[model samples]
Target chain A: DVKVTQSSRYLVKRTGEKVFLECVQDMDHENMFWYRQDPGLGLRLIYFSYDVKMKEKGDIPEGYSVSREKKERFSLILESASTNQTSMYLCASTVAGQGAWTPLHFGNGTRLTVT
Target chain B: DQQVKQNSPSLSVQEGRISILNCDYTNSMFDYFLWYKKYPAEGPTFLISISSIKDKNEDGRFTVFLNKSAKHLSLHIVPSQPGDSAVYFCAARGLNAGNMLTFGGGTRLMVKP
Candidate 1:
């Protein structure tokens, strides 16, 4: 029973404002990911962290960044929120390995609304 | 370009009937496939998975079937229940690539009594 928790389930922000979304996992998985889900677009990866302080850009990383200061916590930062940025964000974690077939444990997700 | 595609936007089925959700992928490199179920306002939960080495994987009432040559896969739920009503997403990952996954747009399943 792995638990992945997101800091906020819902959030509202004005345009041009910076926003932070946090995620924490109890399983101590080495790989954490941030994804934005939009209607018709499915889940597109924004950023991922393989280890503390190590981050990689995913398919849709523009206008977004991530932080992994600790093993258990990963944060997604919206540099400047815009109306188009409004969407559901998901965080997931999994163990580190080559032959690992572990399924990602996901948080409930944060729905952010930018007005 | 959409690498993975779930053609059906929605499907309706009656309780005690079988519900089939189909998904297709364009990438031949994809070696692993997965199915996830998501309720409204909740993140997608892992349902079942199948590797390229095998064509079918079953778990409880859910079964995943993969067709490598056609680059297609499907999820079948037997005796579908109301609780099975949700959005289902099909995902794929390449063997050599990192664990990053490419997901289909998803199909919504509605089970009615």
Candidate 2:
């Protein structure tokens, strides 16, 4: 089974602090994504990387940046954590062209709280 | 603007009964639709999906129905069990959307025995 792992299951950060969320996939999938699940808002994409060193912004990417220097790893960075930034973060991976038809394999998710 | 929407915030059903969850989308660009189930503290998992070309797809007790003209879809679970209790999210993607799937607000389904 494809496994997408997130570095943290729970995290607490202070406002204005820099935060990094890490994700790693073992299936060697070419597409990786970061999304935040908020109440009433659903899962909104933050960023996605289709290849090493390549990144693209999604629906909600204002307070976030991502890095994919390594194919198996994708990192989401919060420039400065804010109270509103606290949310459940999910990482997912899928084979490139099969995205539209195939379902994404997702990690357990990281719950972050900013105070 | 929310492209995909699940108007029901929650639904309750009894075990062995039919549980129907609904979803609607405003964008005609959406060509494929999917249902995802999520438990607390866990990421959502793909439940069932239906392509625009077809109106229905079934897998075991789960079935998905899509109406292209109305831009609406529904998931049906027959013989619903307590294990089926979770938040059901409606998601969609355009043909060329890549790996991005737009998700709805989600409907929490509780199956009581």
Docking class of 2: medium
Every candidate's CA RMSD: 0.8, 1.0
Candidate 2, A78-105: lDDT as tens digits: 9999999989999999889844487889
Note the DockQ of each predicted structure.
0.70, 0.70
**Chain B only, TM-score of each candidate:** 0.97, 0.98
lDDT of 1 at A79: 92
lDDT of model 1, residue B79: 87
DockQ of 1: 0.70
Evaluate model 1: give its TM-score: 0.98
> Model 1: how far is B112 from its true place, Å?
0.2
Candidate 2 lDDT at B65 equals 94
Residue B60, model 1: Cα distance from true site in angstroms: 1.7
Q: Locate the minimum summed-lDDT window of 10 residues in model 1 chain B.
A: B93-102
